[model samples]
Target: MNKKGQLIVVSGPSGVGKGTVLKEYLASRDQIAYSVSATTRSPRPGEEHGVHYFFLSREEFEQTVQSGGMLEYASYNNNYYGTPKKPVEEQRAKGNDVVLEIEVQGALQVKKACPDALLIFIAPPSFEELASRLTGRQTEDSKTVENRLNIARKELLCAKEYDYIIVNDTVELAVQRLAQVISANRYSIKNMKEFLDEVNKHA
Candidate 1:
């Protein structure tokens, strides 16, 4: 079957180990990419441009939005972030699975745009673990941490919308699960039925 490459949409709340899970998956796996999101926020100490995020200025980000360059855009805490569409399409065209590590809103939008894409949610084993992960980072203030916790609860509620919900107890395990999901999705009958049916026309 000549099927297009899969777009795996990974979504979860803050501090859910989603980033860690994806990073580990990337390190071990071949033929896939972790898409870089475009954001107005400044890069942190270790982040690289076009790797962690596009790190655009507010004007450039807004220009992309106005020009329809973004596949999906979301505003949180008054700043803007979006997924640039062209590069993702280009990657997928090369038969590589393009993983979009997006939040729930952008995930849903991708789901609508390409229903064939796989959607997975990475959740912590418990709320406490999630909270610890957030606070343990020591990146945000107490008030910001509190706000994230509040949002986390709400994001968890959308778990039912995804294809699979995998609790990330450890990075290795989560990456393994993600690999399994990708392997299984590649052979899903929905993506192969057309080819099978057409070839059996003489019968």
Candidate 2:
């Protein structure tokens, strides 16, 4: 029988390079599924439905949330974002670790729903550095950047709520740390039940 996979939920402030680190981590691993969230927001350039996110109309998104299709969800910037329940369960059943990159609100909700879920919070090396990164993006206006910074401050406060905190000083280092966490969990006694049972039968 296949060992059940882990459910990992990652939360971090915007522009902290969570995406860069996670992208590299996924590139270097196998049997790790990234949970694509559903959103009511319009897709950005180069973003595809079912790839970047499961884009849905506002009505459809609300209907799913009401009918229990979402595992966790929250509204941000006037748009709804959420993890779909079925895909995550399917990936876990197939012995593939599932990673959910979401906001703090959604992450907390997930923790309540799945007590075994590993919650990791990625943080910037410093608030100043975080500000620099946000402004450096140049994608959004200064006003938007400032808004993100304000939200980030609140998000950082919630870092203490996570099971682990990873300061993303560098993409390479962050990815390495993430790998270490997953490796440690893979060998944890709870995850090693199949091996333990086999040894018990032999004894």
Candidate 3:
């Protein structure tokens, strides 16, 4: 029988380099599956439906949430974002670890829905560094950057709720730590039921 895959949820405040870390991690790990979230917001340039996000109408998104198709969801900037339950389950059924890169609220929701889910929080090396990174992006206006920093403060407070906390001082180091977490989980007692059963059978 194929070993069940793990549901690993990665979350962090904006500008903490979570995306860069996960991008490198996914590129290095072929066996891992990246969970694409569904959103009611319009796709940005170079983004594709079903690839970057499963873009849906507000009504469609709400209906899916109502029907329990979403494993976890949240409203941000007046748009809805959520993880679709089917794809995650499908990937796990094939023995592929599924990674969910989401916000803190959605991560908390996942924890409640799937108690075994591994939650990891990424954090910046320092508050000053985080502020610098947010400004460095130059993607958002100053006001927006300030807003994100405020939100980051709150998100940081929830770091204690995660199973692991990774400090994103460097992309390489963060990816290494994230990889170690996944590797360690593979050998966890909860994931080794089949192996234990086999050993008992021979004994």
User: Top model by TM-score, which number?
Assistant: 1
- Superposed on all Cα atoms, model 2 deviates from the true structure by an RMSD in Å of 2.0
Q: Give a tens-digit lDDT track for model 3, residues 1-203.
A: 22888999999988899989999989967778999999998887889999999999999999999999999999875689899999999999888999999988999999998977899999999999999998997888998898888888989999999999999999999999999998897787767777888888999
Question: Is candidate 1 or 3 superior in TM-score?
Answer: 1
| TM-scores for candidates 1 onward, in order | 0.93, 0.92, 0.92
* Higher-TM-score candidate of 1 and 2: 1
lDDT of 1 by residue, 1-203 (tens): 73567788999998888888888888877888778999888787899998899999899999999999998888765578789999889988897889998888888888898878899999999999999999999998999899989988988999999999998998888888888988887888866776778788856
Candidates sorted on lDDT, descending = 2, 3, 1
Worst 10 residues of 2 by lDDT: 185-194
List model 2 lDDT by residue over 1-111, tens digit each: 228899999989999999899999999789999999999988878899999999999999999999999999998767899999999999999989999999999999998
Which RMSD does model 1 reach against the true structure?
A: 1.5
Which residue pairs show backbone clashes in model 1? Answer: none
lDDT of each: 0.87, 0.92, 0.91
Tell me the deviation in Å of residue 70 in model 3: 0.6
Each model's backbone clash number:
0, 0, 0
